[model samples]
Target chain A: MQSIIAVSELSKVYASGFQALKSIDLDIRPGEIFALLGPNGAGKTTLISIICGIVNASTGGVTVAGHDIRRDYRVTRAMIGLVPQELTTDAFESVWNTVSFSRGLFGKPANPRYIEKVLKTLSLWDKKDDRIMTLSGGMKRRVLIAKALSHEPRILFLDEPTAGVDVELRQAMWEVVRSLRDSGVTIILTTHYIEEAEDMADRIGVINNGELILVEDKNELMRKLGRKQLTLQLHDPLDTIPDKLSAYGLELAAGGVELIYTYDTQGEPTGITALLGELQQAGIRFKDLNTTQRSLQEIFVSLVKKPA
Target chain B: MNFYAIRAIYLFEMARTGRTLLQSVVSPVISTCLYFVVFGGAIGSRITAIDGVTYGAFIVPGLIMLSLLMQSITNASFGIYFPKFTGTIYELLSAPVSYVEIVLGYVGASATKSLILSFIILATAGLFVPLQIAHPLWMLLFLVLTAVTFSLFGFIIGLWADGFEKLQIIPLLIITPLAFLGGTFYSIEMLPPVWQTVTLFNPLVYLISGFRWSFYESSDVGVGVSLAMATLFLATCLVVVWWIFRTGYRLKT
Candidate 1:
């Protein structure tokens, strides 16, 4: 499938000699949620800013649709809506006017109906007449989303949209993002929250130290990296594991009251039946057992923790 | 051409003025009126007329030019500077609108605002002293040219400034001093030869001199030179603005 947005060897070196982004090449598929997971100062914001034309790249280029972002800025920018990390707004301006201002700034003709729909979708219709300063922080964030959607953009770049939002609002925002994706708008969000990416993204990209460390489909990443552990509660405590069970790579915990068996989740047979038969022949008894699987959070930690 | 974007920004800036009526309109008009009362009424009572015009009437054009220059700079500088201060400029940087449209919207609103204030001062000057404009069209021309030129200069200042103090430094330390030395109240002819020559170097003198010529048909320099100088300054400002956008100086990282 053709990509809706393409980035080729994009890099940015600021005036202060800080390299915010290394050579980054990416393709954003149409109507897919691509979550960029990175720690603070990992260049997520810089990458998005460069693509949105707020920042210029020091090397390489980017193309939105088929046109170069620099050569055809108007066409590319008209197709993108950016929700910046900061909650910046005109405190004195009313909600309606500011959002309307955004639609017009994109060279779109007046469409009060569209603006109304956006505000209503973001749950900001009731506060449309109120000054931005008078609204709550959550409402202010929603206003930012409304402003981004005001132009009916095909691609939405949300930079830490739920950074300081409460859980309830975060869920609501996720619903909004899902619906936007459903309506054929491509979403590329950057977040430090592992759960956010796990729950919302179709594909995830991990960035660390100005480099894109990994990019994979959400389920595929989980399936490939996930490990399972079978922990068995013993009938009695033992000081050491018997030598006969050495092939099983069993680890004794809880003062030898339990045995933990680590294995790949994709491994066939899991060796459980053989291990149980051997334990019974060795006169070992088990009280209870439970299985555990590694979560995306653990997988993420392991990927980012490796030496660059 | 992104005409709709230009109109949107222009209206947004104008609406800001409407919201801050006391500061944007009333305050500047009141302060300029004070100049008329003090210089035109109090001091003019003792000085004789320079040419056929009365001392009180002679300062009207100069005073209007003074206010026009100052207000043009203030309106435009603050208009663009506030967005940078508040971080709302991101929307502008990311929008589909071109730099030309941005300049048109901001400088256009700023020039229109300065023109409005200048006309109000002109109207108020009428009640205090008799007024005559020998070439009304020429007067209007000078008014618009000065407003637009200074407003463009202000846009440059706004882009160059990083802090609020920097925004004020040029308008207060440089532009205000230049306007005063540019023959706002007294004509350059009244100065010593060397001083008059030095005053002639101040570019604002041409703007004020041309504007004064339209009012009383008398000026320190020929109207042709004044108009040429005004156009030259305008062209120079345009070139500088174009370079700023081309280089993305202070606008993009």
Candidate 2:
């Protein structure tokens, strides 16, 4: 599929000389949830701001729906809806007015029906006439999402949409994002939560220190980097492992009452049967065994922990 | 053209004024009425007339111009500054609306506000003293041009200010002083020869002179020169605004 948003060689240098983004090239497939996973100060907001036309890029360019962001900003920006991380809103304005205001700002004609539907979708219909300052944190976040969707944008950039939200609201927001994706609105979210990307993204990109270190299919990334561990509860504690068992690279654990074996999840045959045979020849007995795979969180930690 | 966007911004700002009626409308109106009581009643009793117009009527144009300059700048500056302070400017910047539409929406609303207030003051002044508009059309022209010019200047101040204190610095320290010394209360002729020349350097003099001329057919400078000066200031403000948008100063990055 042709990409809906393309960022090529994009870099930003602030007046104070801080480089917020290195050369980042990304092509977001239409209708896919592309989660950008990064830690604090990793340039996620900067990248999103540049794409949404809030920030000027120091070098290179971006295109949305085949139009240059600078040359055809009206067309490009009209196609994008951004839910910024901060819960900034007009404290005095009613929810309905603010959302409608956003719609008009995108050059869209007045459509109270559409605004009503969006508010209802976000469970904000009851609070439509209420001032934004009267709402709770979670409701304000919903208001942001409603405003972003007001213009019926084809692409939505959600920058840390769930930050500071409770677990329940976070789950509900994830459902909303999923439904938006189902409706053919391309989603590009940036989050520090590994579980959020694991649960919601089709493709995940990891950025750190202004560099995009990795971008891959969510499942593919996990499978390729994932490792499995096998732990055996022994019938008897052993003083040491025999030389024959050394070939399996097994380590006595749990004060010698259990043994652990680590292997690549993608390794052929996993060497499990051969390791068991060697264990039996050594006369070691195990009461039970269990296996576990490394999670996306662990993979993420390892990936970001590397020296820049 | 994004006419809908412009309307959205304009209406949004106007609604804000409605919400803050005490500050936007009532306060300025009350203050101008008090000026009629203090300056027109007390001072006019002593100094009978200037340039053949009663002191009470003479100060009417100046007072209206004073309010127009101050209110136009305040309304427009605060209109744009509050968004920046509250961080809602992200939406404005990210929206598809162009810079021209943004300025038109904000400055247009501000100018409208000053215009309305000017009329209100004019009507109230009628209650205190006999009023005459020598050229109502010219008066309207000066009122609009001055409102828009000051509003544009205020927009620049809003963009340049990073703090609430900075927002007040120009209007309070510079503009208010300039307006007072710019022949708002006394004609430039009342000043000595050297002071009159020095007063000519003040831009507000031309605005007040032209505006006062529209009311009493009396002015310190040629009406044509005053109009040209006002247009020149408006052009300068427009150029500054265009440059701000082109460079993305204090807005984009």
Candidate 3:
């Protein structure tokens, strides 16, 4: 599939000598949900701002839908919709007018039908006549999404769309985002929620210290770095592992009532059978045992923790 | 050239004015009327006339210009500043609309609001004093040019101001004082020779003089020079606004 947005050698340096972004290159595939994961001030917003033309790139270029962003600003911007991190709406304006006006800002001709559809999809149709200031935080967020979608752009950039939202509302927001993807809009979201990226993104990009440190298919990234652990609940307490079992690198915890064995998921044999045989010969008994896999959260923490 | 975008921004701003009618329209009108009551009624009764026109009639142009300069700046500056304050400017910056279109929409709506207020004040002034507009077209010409020019000036202030206090500083401290000292209530001829020369340096003097010229055919400066000064200020504001957008000073990061 062709890339809908291409960013090459992009960098941003603020006037105060703060380097927000180092040289970075990225391609957002057509119709894919690409999640950019980063810690605070990790240049996630800076990158999005540059692509959306809210911030000028100190170096390099960006193209959206085959048009250079700087040279064809209007063309590229018209094809993209950005739901900013801030909930900045006209306080006194009704939801209907605000959303309708946003469409007009894109130079698109007015279409009430399209506006109604976007509002309804976001569950904001009921409050369309209400002033934005009167809406709840979740409802206000939906209004922002409705406004972003009002122009029916093919690319949507949601910056932390689920931040500070309740679980139920986040799920509802995810549903709306999925439906938008089904309609052929390419979505790029920046988020601190590992679970959100783990659940939604087809591809993940992890940024750290102003650099694009890792980018890979979600499942592939997990499978490549994932580890498994077999936690055995021992029948009785033991102060130390037998010398014969020390080679397996097992850890005794819960006052030696539980024993944990860590192993690489990709390695052959896992050594579980030999460890079990040695345990039985040593007259060790287990009450129960269970296996678990590392979550994306853990992989993320480990990846970001490594030195640059 | 994005007319739809411009219309969108312009109408949005105008709608905000409607929502805040008291602040945008009623407040300025009421304040001007008070000036008419005190300066026009009490002083008019005592002094009768200045330069053969009734004191009430003589100050009418200055009064209108006073509100025009302040309203034009207040309306435009607040219009843009509010968006920046709320961070809604990000949506505008990210939109396909060009910088020129954004300025047109904001400045256009602000000027429109000031124009409406000026006319209302004109009609209200007529209610208090028997009035005649010697050059109705020139009155409108000065009215529009001054509104557009000062609206641009207000736009610069909006971009330059980082806080609400800074937003009001120019209109309150700088423009209002200059308007009063620029002969909004009395003529420069009423002042000493040295003071009149110093007052000439105040740009508000030219705006009021030219506007007063349209009403009574009497002014401290030639109508041409007044017009020239207003135009020069307009051109300078345009250049500054252009440079702002070009450099992405405050509008873009």
- Write model 1 residue lDDT over B1-253, tens digit each, in one string: 9998999999999999999999888987788778878888999888899888888999899889988988888889899989988999999999998989999999999999999999999998998999999999999999999999999999999999999899889888997898888888888999999999999889999999999999999999999999999999999999999999999999898
Report the lDDT tens digits of candidate 3 across residue range B91-121: 8998998888999999999999999999999
**Distance from true location, Cα of A128 in model 3, Å:** 1.3
lDDT top scorer: 2
lDDT at residue A221 of model 3 (Cα atoms): 87
Which runs of model 2 end up more than 4 angstroms from their true locations? A238-242, A252-255
Name the Cα RMSD for model 2: 1.3
Question: If the candidates were sorted by their DockQ against the true structure, best first, what order would they fall in?
Answer: 1, 2, 3
lDDT tens readout by residue for model 2, B1-253: 9999999999999999999999988998899888888888987879858989998899999999999999999999999999999999999999998999999999999999989999989999999999999999999999999999999999999998899998899999999999999998899999999999999999999999999999999999999999999999999999999999999999877
Residue-wise C-alpha lDDT for candidate 1, range A223-248, written one tens digit per residue: 88878889999998878889999999
How does model 1 do on interface RMSD, in angstroms? 0.5
Instruction: Arrange candidates, best lDDT first.
Output: 2, 1, 3
DockQ, in order, for the candidates? Answer: 0.93, 0.91, 0.79
Better of 2 and 3 by DockQ: 2
User: Residue pairs in steric clash, candidate 3?
Assistant: none
* Sliding window of 10 residues with minimal summed lDDT for model 3 chain B: B42-51
